[model samples]
Target: MEIFPAVARVTFDGQVRSFDPSVERTEMERGLPKQRLLNSQVLVKQSMTLYFASIGDATTFESWYFDVIKRIGWFEMVHPYSGQTIKARFENGALGDLVPDEKLTGDFKMDTVVEYMR
Candidate 1:
């Protein structure tokens, strides 16, 4: 018998972190006719912001960080919170500039708006 280890993480092109991937969803609805639902737009392909936080004492700098941070294209994402591996694209991302005196470690955070591609 074969088994896989239980892993909870957020990953992009190999950069991995064992943390909750915050998934945001837009309530597609109209403010009329008793607030009707607009549509059930696949759920994944709708506009969303992915929140990723590093584990304690860990640096945000990863080998695949740049490619994920700078590149503009669709990529696969493993969302621990949603429990689904979905296709998404980077709409925007932000990180405060690392200072000389400040240490670069732990809980380095970034929130990005990603539109599901597939």
Candidate 2:
């Protein structure tokens, strides 16, 4: 039985990103890991902090950040610049994961996914 993981495609600021990877599970567990998958899609609204490591003074760029989905359904990001924090609500658009998974061994594969509100 070959079961494939679900794929999530998200768009923001007129850009579309796709995430295709398997959900993580422990050796003793039979279900997916509780953590959000890397490359998973999410939504972000205005007033949300888009964090990035600037090249000198430039602030924003096309990049990816690992964000956490809050219970209130907002996305929180730690500004890589100021070290301050910011958040995006479900009202704006969507966010997604763009990080790739690391292959530990030949048969062992572990990855993460993101959650979003639509």
Candidate 3:
């Protein structure tokens, strides 16, 4: 199996951007390099101090984040589009290679932090 190191940044406004240093076209074409590698896509959602929103409610915002990560091209699966059924392995980390820092302010702040590792 090959390991792809990635960095992602998420802002308070629900803007997310990602970068992967070891990602390449060949690696992406071959997917996650496991015969039984799970097929999944990464979906990111954020909740501010007073509001909650789902991916369906902000498709364009989610797409922007997805696009940044897709540039890394580290998976061997088809790209997922809105309303499309696709599978992809999920992974998460922060940009700058640091562990994510989270704080609680509201009733559901703890639930706001999400991470997926493949």
Judged by lDDT, which candidate is best? 1
Report lDDT (Cα) of residue 16, candidate 3: 40
The TM-score obtained by model 2 is 0.20
Tens-digit per-residue lDDT, 19-116, candidate 3: 32233233346557423323343343222111213323234323433564442223322222232322332344222222223442321111122222
Tens digit per residue, CA lDDT, model 2, 11-73: 132322233353564454666546545545444322222222222111112222222232224
Return the TM-score for each candidate structure: 0.36, 0.20, 0.18
Task: Give stretches of model 1 more than 4 Å off.
Answer: 1-65, 68-70, 92-107
> lDDT tens digits, residues 21-117, model 1?
3344455566533333445453332332222334421233332345434545455665544667666554453333332222233333333344553
Q: Which model is ahead, 2 or 3, in terms of lDDT?
A: 2
Q: lDDT for every model?
A: 0.38, 0.30, 0.29
Order the candidates by TM-score, highest first.
1, 2, 3
Clashing pairs in 3: 31-76, 39-87, 39-88, 40-87, 40-88, 40-89
Highest TM-score: give the candidate number.
1
Judged by lDDT against the true structure, how good is candidate 2?
0.30
The TM-score that candidate 3 achieves is 0.18
